[model samples]
Target: MKSIVTADGYHVPVLLRESVDGMNITPESVCIDVTFGGGGHSREILSRLGNNGHLYGFDQDMDAIDNLPEDAKFTFVRSNFRYLKNFMRYYDEDSADAILADLGVSSHHFDDSNRGFSFRFEESLLDMRMNSKHSKTAAKILNEYQEERLADVLYLYGEIKQSRRIAASIVNRRKTKSFKTVSDLLEVLEPFTGKAKEKKILAQAFQALRIEVNEEMEALKEMLTQALDILKPKGRLVVITYHSLEDRLVKNFFKTGNFEGKADKDFYGNLNTPFKLVNNKVIIPSEEELVINPRSRSAKLRIAEKL
Candidate 1:
């Protein structure tokens, strides 16, 4: 399957066919693509929909506006997916047959040096907000957060074992000169970025700051909870996660209807859940897909149906 590309090549959808196929679209089924970065998945969903079927594409990034498909069956919601329920209510949509979310950062973001999503752009300011209007930025978090809080962000979000030491270093260094640019933070992280794992450590540190700035985990939780409410019985929930943090939440939610991954048992020992797992095992990008879109190496697809 060839990767789908938008006019500006905003993103090449990862697990393109597999993710959309998991939706099990019907000609008249209404669907929602909550992460409409490049409209790759939404476009595919629209293609499968009949005239009566409607698809709502949600995105907070201003860049996504240019990629919107001009079709009567599609509506673009210019808001974060965390407010999925609120927007659905505002639009008078009671339920949807399918919902898809691709939780990876778009290629456009990483490729755009000004976004500061990639560590390679040392000259750029650390402004990693997906929605530029948001008040919080990576620079603010690095400069403002206390040592303990900063450590927690890196430890939990980035899974950096030396987070406390790193945070302390950052706090000590910022006393004289506050962090402003990617290079500022990079200088503080110098000790940790050894030759063998230089790129890996830097990537983790940047990811931590970006996640904190965007409140990604919280938003994902809110969106998933609302998805349960807005999906019709037997409706499908398909998600493509790029990291273990997001994948764990989606996996737990699908299997047990909670983030803790605990299963509730009835008298017959039946595992009670709002959703039935559509894929027992997670789906990863095929070798061919990885060759086509190398950034999709970490992509994992999971699907579930509302019971």
Candidate 2:
């Protein structure tokens, strides 16, 4: 294992051992790490691979791309995980033996003050686009979106109960000047964010913006659907999600191969889904890992296999 703290400190792979162990890697396993942030999970998968084994990693962040390890077995794709199928088809003839995704924002994004991912960084610009190539930023959403739409994002993604009031507050304030920095938005949100729940509210607000900017939910659906198509028979699909929205999606997909959470039945009343649950219960970090990386507390690991 690399030092818990690296020079760049990109991201600590959440549920590292559990996620990879669920993949059931073999000597010649062809693996894909769809959300390779710091390459921690990718490195772990590589260590388990034999000479003929190959690993492909996908990440849109330039910082992650720059930190990719150099090795013949590892191929890094500078693209979002939403394009999983396209890249998978282009690279390997046979379907991947296993696929792993660690969903949500990585540690680096939250830790880096300039990225504007953390509410702690008040002076930082409200630009939470994970991929710089993305056009819309958090600032743009706050400044330009209609009150109803903004409220919808907050309610749906952040699960904020006072989304409407917050939206109204944002629109009223933005009429004077557009929101540009974290502090600018905080000033408007402070009234609603009680002293006891300020951090929680701010985090939810930031998560809503980040999800909107990155199209996280839609992309996740696309990736999950594509993953089902790209995995070989009995191949593993291991995902570690950080929030209920994402966890629910993964759970539903694993159980029924559908986001609607409905499992289709065949003529004989047999389940028609292509996947079978490998782990019925959600997996979380062990006490030891929690002590080492507190951020992993929110991670939920779900493993499924293609039928």
**Candidate 1 accuracy as TM-score:** 0.97
lDDT of 2 by residue, 99-133 (tens): 99988887678878998988889999999988999
TM-score of every candidate relative to the true structure: 0.97, 0.96
RMSD for each model, in Å, please? 1.9, 2.1
Which stretches of model 1 miss by more than 4 angstroms?
Answer: 1-7
- Using TM-score as the measure, the top candidate is 1
Error of 1 at 74 (Å): 0.7
lDDT of each: 0.91, 0.89
